[model samples]
Target chain A: MTKVKVAINGYGTIGKRVADAVALQDDMEIIGIAKTRPNFETVMAKDKGFNVYTLADRVGAMEKEGIEVSGTVEEMIKAADVVVDCTPGKVGATNKDLYEKAGIKAIWQGGEAHTLTGCSFNAETNYDEALGKDFVRVVSCNTTGLCRVLSPLDKEFGVKKARVTLLRRAADPGDIKTGPINAIVPNPIKLPSHHGPDVKTVIPNIDIATTAVKLPTTLMHLHTINLELEKECTAEDVESVLAEQSRVRFVGQGITSTAEIMELAKDLGRSRGDMWENCIWNESITMYEGELYFFQAIHQESDVIPENIDAIRAMMELESDASRSIEITNKTMGI
Target chain B: MTKVKVAINGYGTIGKRVADAVALQDDMEIIGIAKTRPNFETVMAKDKGFNVYTLADRVGAMEKEGIEVSGTVEEMIKAADVVVDCTPGKVGATNKDLYEKAGIKAIWQGGEAHTLTGCSFNAETNYDEALGKDFVRVVSCNTTGLCRVLSPLDKEFGVKKARVTLLRRAADPGDIKTGPINAIVPNPIKLPSHHGPDVKTVIPNIDIATTAVKLPTTLMHLHTINLELEKECTAEDVESVLAEQSRVRFVGQGITSTAEIMELAKDLGRSRGDMWENCIWNESITMYEGELYFFQAIHQESDVIPENIDAIRAMMELESDASRSIEITNKTMGI
Candidate 1:
């Protein structure tokens, strides 16, 4: 099989991780990476041996500042079979026309609106929906985490309603700017925070309500979830189903807090201490009068990385089976 | 009329603020403040002209370290008519016996469980319940904020069910050690956080469920509340009722965030930038299909300060009327 040439159009947290994951895939190759400026991340991308490209306008300026570049982003897009647009939240919408002009299939991150691609991709739930699609968006990290756990549960027990309260990280580890610094904010100050509606974009059948509170931690997003399953189930039964999934890991052996989870990742020698799996506390799993209650932590920076790779396979028709794609991606990424 | 002598058992965040509020009330006077350690706050309390007292065992050690003590906590309790126990959370329960042994009426902060006092005081909702009681526990800052708003609303519109999500500050501003540093935490990681039950202790008739998330904030707690009222009401109708309450302050005039609200307090020259009222966002007050939605910020350090003073009055029989006590507390504290 000819390798799918995947161009990563951003070298930040999610972008760089996706680039590495795609590089590990037997059926995919990193064509080039696009950087907006000559920052340390831009240099790091080049040092990692990925062919680096810059904005059409920044190509001259970036090279003038002693940064090497393969070509303009537009040139890279024309050469690649698909472009994974990770250029911040709203920037993906602006780059849609450029990909269209280049006549290339593109994958946008969860930051972009689902309407931008008209289809949201979650490898475990809706990979087939993205198959052969010209444009696809991988849902946001929180939504990705939610879909991973909720999809299988809904399929097994049928969800009556799922209510989640998220203790969201204020910023990614390397990010210094974003903060409440010392305040808990009802972000948007509205009921049913956007995560609930965002989940609907993927697992459209599930009844979910999410309320998110931004916190000071950069490591992970912790979710306290209460699910009223349509079918009665034991905590052990629910645990068995969750444990069966490749992307979910149960936290035990004295690892109780998010801090400990991150420490475990660091001890495991994972890059950037990334725990791509949903880190749910083993003891927190409880079945009280037919309702399931548990706490799970999502490594926001990397949980969606594998999904992005699976998204690439689905869009390119390289992998028709989602589990097969997920298996391959997981094996290569060592998730 | 003889002034009620109040003794503060802890000279920390809530304790110091309560002492100052008590000092401001015409019907109350601070007999002394109890500090476990001769910290900077201990010195500050002494410098502020509060008679600083320590544990009977620590009095010798504190005095050896050049700290002046008027008496032991037991002696202070004996002299005062009502002892406000503000020593950290579980410590109040331990000190319950001391107050009983001294044959003095006592008020415990929300840190203590309701069972310890058998009566939770909110001043607005259940001040009468605490009248002349031997032991009365003030509800938590979040609970106090909830009761102040919910009590008035439940009376005016009749609430069917109320749901609240609290973004709780991890620590007080003066606190240096407590932190996720950069994380949001599901405080109890359980369904219906303790605040709902805490509120129930004050207003048992109101059906309420609360979920709390701990954030890296030290300034204040932000609550996103959704209440289903029994009676149909417009946004204007709800706003007028809330506005009538003296303890609920509407945030308007471009005050969009908690930081600005704190800054507003500082600009107003409030002591330590304390906002004793629930700072509800004026624009967030909305009535949608019989459901009321709004955002309110609780100054965790000071919101309960006024309630402490009112509790003293109720327990001493200095004030028979709840509104009268609340009005007096509010006028003196500049709420």
Candidate 2:
């Protein structure tokens, strides 16, 4: 089978991780990476043997900075079968017309509004929805983390409602400028943060409400979740379902925090100490009076990497079975 | 006003903080602090002018270690108006018979089973239940934190049910031996971790379920709470209620994590950087579709201090009004 040509637009946090993951897949090829500047990331992308494409107007500036460029983003888009847009929030919406004009399918990040793609994708939740679709928006790190757990719970127990409080990292570790240096800030200062609504785009019927606060830590985002089930169940019953999921890892006894999990990932020789699986402390899974509660940590930089790869297979119709695609993506990326 | 003589048993963690808070109260006097051994904490207690007493059998050993003993635990109990039993876990149960034999009213920590005391105390929730009681158990740091928020929510909006996930601290900062060094561990490993039932001890009528996971930090415990209200309310409405309560401190923007909260406490010159208030990030308080949600940090080491003081006031019948007692405790302890 011929490899599906893939172009990653926006070479930053999500984009870089997704590019590495896409390169690892046997069924996918990295046609190029698009960047707006000739920064260190562009040089690193070039060093990784990925062709670096700049914006059509920025190519000259990139070349002036002594960084070699393969072509413009337009050229890369035209050459690739599908493009994954990992640009900063809202930028993807602007790039939609360009991808549509090129007649190439595209994948957008969670930062992009869901309306930009009309369909939000999560491999575990709504993989089939992306099949044969022209564009798909992979939900944010927090939303993807939620779907990984909620999808299975909804399927097995039937969710009545879900309330999630997201303890978000202030900024990506690599980004030095973003705050909150000394305070926890609520992103929206409103009820039902955009995350729950984002999830609805993928699973329309589930009732979820989310409130988010940004913490000063950059290691990972912690989610405290409570799901009201359709019927009564034991903590063990809920654990059994979460334990069986491929993307969900039950962190038992010894592993305590996201810091320890990250250390374990490094010790396991994972690239950049990235843990692609949602680390849900097994002991934390509790069921009481018809509700399921648990605490899970998400590696913001890498948890969505596998989802992006799954989305690629989804958009191109390269794999009809989500499980099969997820399995392949997980195995290839060492998730 | 004649000051109530208070004996603090167990001179570590909660015991130490309770002793300090009790000392701050104009109506209470720390008669002595009980310690099994002459450790550094015992020395520190003595340096603070607290009368340090050792177990009868360890009195000689304590004296030999250059620690001056004011009296034996038995003598301290017999002389005090009320003995606060801060002994570790099940040990409190063993000491209960001693307190009863001495005819001294006693207060126990949350670690002790609620059955041991017959009355569990959260000043805001059950100050009246504790009034004139021979024995009272102050709920755990986590439960104390929950009650501070839930008591108000239940009173104003009428809570139908509450689900809380406690992100607990692995150990108190001063303790070197306690974990979890590298992982998040769920204590009890069962549904409705003892916390929910513990809360029932304070507010018997409110429906609440709690699950707890100990993270790798000793700074503080974070609670993600969802309360299902009997009627609809807005986030601002819920914030207004929490703000009116003295123990619930609304942490607005610019204060990001527990680490920062601790820093602010230090900047404010709090002893040991203790924050008695439940630091609820104001912006995090949100209500959606008749359900309320928010994130709050509990300074595990110090939050229960004020509750312990209030417990003493209630047990002695010195303060019949819960609000009045809470106000005095909070004002005196710099909560």
Candidate 3:
């Protein structure tokens, strides 16, 4: 298979992780990294011998100070076949059109989905729908981690109702923007939360009620899940299946400790927001003969890494070729 | 009408409130105050012109050392025509039979109800059931506030489902025990939070799920409630009815500010737990034309104060004989 060319737009936490993962992939090559912000990560990316691109304002400053930078979004788009837009939510709505116009397939981050049209990809649950689509927006870390467990079970297990309480991070990965909720105590003003409705855009017909509390934590978002299942299965039986998933680790005894989840993420050098990479505990997932219970921890920053790799796979028109996709995932993950 | 005599079985924070409330009633008279541990409160009651009795291990301490105490359960039981068991849970289970055998009609606290009970009284919805009954356990502070507001509406308006997240206080008037929740962690478990099923023993048909978090403050408990009604009503209608109830306070534009709820609670002292005293904001109580809507916040501690007063009325046989009951409530509250 031809080597895949990948470019990460927005070299924030998630974007850079995607850049690093693509470089390790045997079948993929990191063509460019575009960042609008000045940060340690951006500086670190440049020192690593990768082609780092800066915005026009930075490029102009570099021009005066004799520092080189990529000046336009178009230049970054032209650098690779697949562009991953990791900009904040509203940015993706407009950038989705630009990427498609440049004939470069793009994967929009959770924040950008409000403007995208193609599909929302949660690898385990909706990878097939996302394949061959030009613009794929990966759902939020919490949603992706949960749907990985639920959509599959809801299809096999029959759900009566579901309730989720998301314990979120106080700040986004790095400084993005200070919204209204920053200083204020962000309480759930509406039921099911906006996260549930966002989940519905893809996994329709799921009766979900989500509530969230933004805590002072920085990396992982914890979701306490409760769902009534139609068929009864022993907790042991369900645990075994979840443990086998490639990206998911069935965390132990239901409430997986924060330390354990972080150890797994660190071992993988997972930046943040990597689907299925979020640690989920099997015991926290109580499957008591048709009654399913569990708590899932999703690394909000690194979960979308694998999806970004997949975007490059689609861009190269090798989506149906699992052999090529697997090569890319393994290479990107340095496995 | 013959006024009923009430003996306070335990002279602690709650017990004192009960005793003071009873003293204010014209039809009700406090036979005396009983204490197993003759602490400062017992002495304070005695100094304040109360007839105090003790069930301490050794009454010699009060006689010789000048520290008053109750010597035995037997003496406390014999002293009152009716005994109110405010002892802690699990511990109270052991003594239920003793209170029953003594023919000392009893009124129990919420925690004690899991072990004993004739009825869980909220006065407005279930007061009649407690009348003429031998044992009446007042619902939990959270349950008392929630049921009073929802039950009345559920009866008047068609009901569907309900969800409540309680940010409870670290202490109640007499909660000597440390808190179960150290911080705002989702009730360590991942299911529909078992607290709801416990609430169900009283309102069986209602689908109630509760998530409780304990904060450091002792002022009041706050609840964000979402319910699906069989019929539709505007936020204004809910506000009017809540304001009409003595314990429910319409604090306006959603009970968003925790500080504001405290202010309302302070101003409404004595009457603080009046049926409608706890503030529920008009804005926070969002109503949709559809079946589902949201309403938030009822100061848990003070909201139930009025009900406690009312429970005293019925416990003292002052409900049917209204004149004496009104006088009691007035004097206890200093109104």
Candidate 4:
């Protein structure tokens, strides 16, 4: 079988992780990775043996750093079977023309709005919809994590309504700039923050309302979910159903905070201490008056990495089944 | 009539404004102000002709700064009939003993939990409840702003339920350390953030839920409120009701953002550009499907200043009616 050639644009947090995960897949080969700057990330990418590509203006900077530049981003996209546009939030829209010119399938990350692709993809929920599609978007990290649990829970217990409070990390750990170092801030200050609507793009029928706040920590995004189940169920029933889902972990062994969860990820020898699963606190699971309550920590940096891999497979028609795609991606990445 | 001797403990943001507001009131006398540091704020306090007091340990810092130190916080509290503990959060809980021992009534700011005083205050709703009370806690800035509008709306239209989304400032403008300089963060990541319960402390029967997120701005907190009214009302009726409120202003005439509201406050030549009113966007007021919707900006620094003044009057029994105290406080501060 011919390997699916994947070109990753933007070699920062999500881009770097997705590149590594794609490299591990048996049916995929990374053509090149794009970087806007010749920072330490590019040095690390080169050390990892991934070809570094830059914009025409930034090529001088990359060569100045003694890093080999394969070609411009436009040239990189032209060579790949699929281009994963991980450029920052709205930059994906501007890059759409290049992908269309290349005439190859492209995948965009959650940063771009759903209208850019018209179809949002989550391996567990909407992989089939993305099969053989020319363009698809992997929903954001938070939305991806939400779908991992809510979709399965809805199918199993039938969700009447879902309310989520996201205690979001101020920034990724490596990020030194972004912060409200000693404050708790409400993000949108608008009811049903966009997360709920973003989730609907993937799980359209799921009724979920999300409220989020940014605190002083840069560890992981902790979600406090309260779901009103249509069918009566016990905590054990909910636990078993969630446990059966991939990329969802029941974490409880004196692991009380998001800090400890990150420590666990590092101790587990995971790459870059990346937690690719929804780390749900086992002790927090509760069944009260037909409503299920639980807390889950989503590593904002890497939770969506696997979804990006599966999205690539689905878009390339390399994998017909989502579960098979997820299985293959997980085994290859050691997730 | 004897003046109410008011001592402000913690001469920072709220404390300084409260001191100015108190000095304006005919029935109140500023005994002194407390400061933990000899910062520029304390310098301003001295320049404003207010006496400054520090802790016994912090006396040297004040002396070194060449600012006159009146006495210790303990000594300041003893001289006053009522003490407003404007110290940072949790610090007020410790200061409660100082007020109790000094045999003076104390008013704590919203930073302290409602349980700290058992009686939470919003002058518009709970002034009578605070009458002659030895210990009363004033709710936070956001809660005070909510009460200013919600209480009057509930009385006029009979609110069934209220939902609010808070777009909170990461920090006050003077704060240089706190930030998420380029990101929006969910402050608590929990449903029905504490603001809702804080509001209940004032309007105990009203059902309200709040979700908040913090952004990079430090201008003011903007709230999007949705209320389900028991009685049907049009946008015009809701507008008229809020328009008549003492500390709530209908902001229009091309005022589109919180920064603009702050600009308006500064242009009005208000002290410190502090807006003590709930600057509601008149254009945002909407009545749809038996619910009222609008956006209001809460000046986190000054919205609670007027409430602190009213709390002192209520606690001192200087004013018998809530409206009388609110009127006196508003007129004195030019709110």
Share of native interface contacts recovered by each model: 0.41, 0.31, 0.07, 0.00
lDDT-wise, the better of 1 and 4 is 1
Model 4: how far residue A120 lies from native, Å = 1.8
lDDT of 3 by residue, A61-174 (tens): 544544356546678788777777877678767776677778877788787653465577666666666667777787777777777777766777676677666666656545
Clash pairs (backbone) in predicted model 1: A182-B217, A183-B217, A216-B182, A216-B183, A217-B182, A217-B183
lDDT by residue (A1-335, candidate 1, tens digit) is: 79999999988988999998888889999999999889888888878899999887898878887888899998999999999999999988999999999999999999899899899988899999998999999998899899999999999999988877777887888888887666555565555668888999999988876666676677898887778798888988899999999999988787646888889999989988899999987677877545677889999999999999999999899989988999999999887
Q: Select the stronger candidate by TM-score from 3 and 4.
A: 4
Estimate, for each residue in B1-335, the C-alpha lDDT of model 1 and write its tens digit.
Answer: 78889999988888898898888988889999999998889988988999999988898888987888998888999999988888889988998888889999988888888899889988889888988898999888999999999999999999987777788888877778887665556666645677888898888888876666677778888887878898888988988998998998988786756888999999999999989999987677766544677889999888888888888888899989999988888787777
Best by TM-score: 1
The fnat score for candidate 1 comes to 0.41
Separately for all candidates shown, the number of backbone clashes (residues 3 or more apart, or on different chains) is 6, 12, 55, 21
lDDT of 4: 0.84
**What does the lDDT read for residue B331 in candidate 2?**
85
Instruction: Give the per-residue lDDT of model 2 (tens digit) for B1-335.
Output: 99999999998888888888888889999999999988889999999999888888898999999999988888888889999888898999999789888999999898888888788888888889989999898888888998888888888889998877677777778878986554435454555677887788788898988766665567888877878898688888888888898888877657767777888899999998988889987776766676677778888888888888999999899989988998898888776
DockQ of each: 0.40, 0.26, 0.15, 0.08
List model 4 lDDT by residue over A56-157, tens digit each. Answer: 999988898898899999999889999988899998889999999889899999999899999998889889999999999999989998999999999998
Docking tier of model 1: it is acceptable
